[model samples]
Target: MELNYEGFYRFVRDELNVDLNAYKEKQLKRRIATVMKSSGALTLEDYSELIASDEVIRNKFLDYITINVTEFYRNKDIFTDFEFILRDYLNRQFKNIKIWSAACSIGAEPYSLAMILDKNNIKTNEKIIATDIDDNILKKAKDGVFKDFEIKNLDKKDLDKYFIEKENKYYIKDNIKGMVSFKKHDLVLDKYQKGFHAIICRNVIIYLKSETKDEIYKKFNESLVKGGILFTGATEAIYNPKEFGFKKISTFIYEKI
Candidate 1:
């Protein structure tokens, strides 16, 4: 039986309340194939039946849709711009330097930001809340583990200062690890963290539709205090900001007004 991928998507939406239609088809299909291959379903209908009827399959679908690739200091330009905003944040905010790493897969981005704060002596008064929809990734993130290659882009001093090299891998050290708190959060259903100093939600939105991107951006804007910075990945940005109460801070940066 040939599975109707279109029908499967509709079932996922109406039954699960998860919008598979929001994702880019090419990417979505690629991920779906991984599950299908694992299930060894020769026909599309068989795969659709498996996906629609099994709760485990439903969770797997969410995992595939939300999991994404990341590296430390991904896109140097974004970090460079973010650093300037961090300095500004330090100057103005004395307490509750709350930051939310929405969709902080495996914790690289949040750990990287933690290293930056520790280096600048801003970690003392600051707090970072890292969230992901997937519990599997969140557990790894909470452990603060990383392979050596994950930190390859770092300079020698930074690598030495922030990471402990052991057993052929590197782990973010206590200084940075203590700076973050990880939790399970779904961007679609959860309320925003209020009055944060910054929100680094990079790369994850490319999987979402423009409407979702705008919806999340609006939440981010409302979550931030005046002058709070919102960082996005290169080639990923909110399609509009007036609706979100944010102003373009730079090419890939925005600040709440």
Candidate 2:
């Protein structure tokens, strides 16, 4: 039998609680097919059974579909510019900043933000919220353990200051680890929390459908306080910021106006 993507989507929605419909159909289908094939499943229905029955297969399926490729200080130049904006602009504007690192894979992005905050001594009312749809990734994030490749972007100074090297792995220091709190959040379906001084959601939204992306941008705008910043990935710039109550302040950065 041919792949039953409609049935698979429903199965994923009802069982996995992930809305596959929100993602670009063609890209998602291609990714699904690739992962499905790796499981030696002839059909999507069989693949779904394997995913449901085997925890390893289930984790693999979720990890693959979510596309969680990330590292500390991803795109060094962009992060450097963002750090400057955080210290010079957002810090000056807000007394106690609230940041949300959406789609944070394995906690690197939020941890990077925490490092920036700690280095600058920026005070926050609460811990920085780092969220992802994948619970398995969230658990790894909470553990704060990383491989060398995952932290290759960090300079020696930051590495020495922020992490403790044990054997072949690096563990995030308690001080920095305390700065961020991890949670499970689905951007496509969950209600966004409001009054954030800055919302950093990068890379993930590019895979979503246009209408879904627009809706998410709207939600992100509403979630931020007036004059807050919304940071996007290098390739995910909003063509028209005004449509989302944003003003293009810099490359890949938007100010909620």
Candidate 3:
């Protein structure tokens, strides 16, 4: 049989439970092609067979597709804005806040939020739920050790307060680490947990198709309480926030209405 992209997509869904249809087709295809080239498979069928039998190849494919590029306080200006919003908007309404860091690669975003909460003195009994699709990334997040480059945006005071530096690596302090709970979650397939005071799903939905992004936004709106916040990536702003029952609160911040 000829190399079939559709068949390959189905095979991946069956084997990995990841729906490629949600991802932008052109970008997904380009990534798949790169994997195929690296694996020396000229045909999609050959690559699919290789992935089916080889654990290493399968994991590589999963990792590549997930796009795990993250850093502590990524897009520093936006996070600065978020800290203010958290203190002024969220803290005032919710006494014990529940936050979800969806597609939270390596835990930087949630940990950053935890630090902000700590700094602002927002006493919350509930821990932040930090989740990602990749199991390996979740493990790394649990470890909470980061290189200097990963935390470049953090100030010296915040660094000294929340991290212990040994050699060149920075380990998150027990207090900060304890405030976050990491888990493996696929945003496309998994049902969203509700009643969140805020949800930070940044730099992720840009890779998905418009319809899929819309569906996820709607789900996020449903997942949050009325007047809850949805903090998106700097580049992933919702053009029509009202469509998803959200009103634009700031540059990348949306409030559930």
Candidate 3 runs further than 4 Å off: none
Selected candidate, larger TM-score, 1 vs 2: 2
For model 1, which pairs clash? Answer: 2-45, 3-44, 3-45
TM-score of model number 1: 0.85
Order of quality (TM-score): 2, 3, 1
lDDT of 3 at 127: 94
lDDT tens digits, residues 1-257, model 3?
96588888899899998899899999999999997899888998889889999999888888888889999999998899989989987899888899999999988889999999998899777899999998888988999999988999999999999999999999999999999998888889999999998999999999999999999999999999999999999899899999999999899999999
| Model 1 Cα lDDT, one tens digit per residue, 215-256 | 778888889888788888897866676678988878788878
lDDT of each: 0.79, 0.94, 0.92
How does model 2 fare in lDDT? 0.94
Residue 19, model 2: lDDT of 98
Q: Best to worst by lDDT, what's the order?
A: 2, 3, 1
Deviation from native of the Cα of residue 135 in model 2, angstroms = 0.8
lDDT by residue (1-257, candidate 2, tens digit) is: 54478888999999899999999999998999898899999888788889889999999999999969899988889888899999999999999999999999999999999999999989899999999999899999999999999999999999999999999999999999999989999999899999999999999999999999999999999999999999999889999999999999888989999
